[model samples]
Target: MESLKYHRLQQRLGYTFVDQKNLQLALTHRSHGATNNERLEFLGDSILNFVIGEALFKKFPEAKEGQLSRLRSQMVKGETLAHLAREFAFGECLVLGEGEMKSGGHRRDSILADTVEAIIGAIYLEAGLDSCRDRLHSWYAERLAALSLETTVKDAKTRLQEHLQSLQKPLPEYNIVDVNGEAHAQLFTVECKIATLSQSATAQASSRREAEKQAAAAVLARLGL
Candidate 1:
């Protein structure tokens, strides 16, 4: 039954493994056992960076280094990867421990994202670099094709700060509204306050920086900028 499920997942992923065990290992979470996907996640992370970097370089020949870097970061970030995982129904295929399973670990963005990377590493090991690159391109096809120079612009926080500076208005301030969850996987809630704006904007994420960015994005949206 497990093999059948894995086979279905492989069909969805558009890649078959020569050594099926590698694929199984890729889907196994750390909480499942000592021998889990962490090593594969590390390996896959390096391969992903290189594959995406090369694709960006060729796709945007006229783009500068900073622009390419931003594009690559957006492409491989946890949010995007988690989005892809959902599209692939990766949550159905994960092997998590009793604790994680009860807590809905498969639905967690971080876990889903890490499993995607671990699968990438497994693909490379079972097949080869070219095979891994081809699979990555296939998975990221629509996203890569949609890239534009405008998408490489600075993040919301930087843009908001610059907009305020241009008008000589007081800079935006970010305050931690709340922090929840365990120490290792904390969720930070941030409130962005601008003196010019009457109301504060709030957002939450797994990290302080990401929470701040989310809050800034909300503030920007509220300000209609």
Candidate 2:
């Protein structure tokens, strides 16, 4: 079932194999390949840690182990791998049999992410670490943003800062523009500014910090920042 197009894609990945079957096996879904990429994915998970961890070690010498570990964790998360798989359009290339295809298998994160690891394992098997590392870095370039989504989405300030940084900058600034009426019935107007983009919101509160957060939310919506 080899095709020139698939072969060209394999060449782009930089690992041409004698048995292309392992590579094919890696791409197969459980519905198609029986055992599927699960086992390969497990092996790839460790290989990914080894490769990305080594990368972090070299990339940030001054970073403490905690910091480096955090970075690696971000890279290898299921959501991150799923996003990375999309970037390479791996979802489109997944070889699902009739049953899995009918079940929308391509959209499954566990499946797609496992395929990514299996492909990495296939690379490792064919050409070893250097080749596999190169393919992985190229594949993972875009999903690094998923890391900036923060340790959790519940922290608005952290999310906002990360969104800004993904654009290569720091958090936006909010300034109190006006306070209207009397102290008992005060209204605050706060402006959130990021570079040239600005948004303002007004809220009644007993203190300034609460009003600032409202303004920040407005700015986030304005720039989608």
lDDT of all the models against the reference?
0.92, 0.69
Per-residue CA lDDT of candidate 1, range 62-154, in tens?
A: 999999999998999999999999998999999998888988999999899999999999988888899989999999999999999999978
- What's each prediction's TM-score? 0.86, 0.59
Error of 1 at 132 (Å): 1.6
Tens digits of per-residue lDDT for model 2, 139-195: 665544344323423334455677888889866776787787543234566666667
Scored against the true structure, residue 155 in model 2 reaches a CA lDDT of: 30
Alpha carbon deviation, residue 80, candidate 2 (Å): 1.8
Give the number of colliding residue pairs in candidate 2. Answer: 0
Q: Candidate 2: deviation at residue 51, Å?
A: 0.4
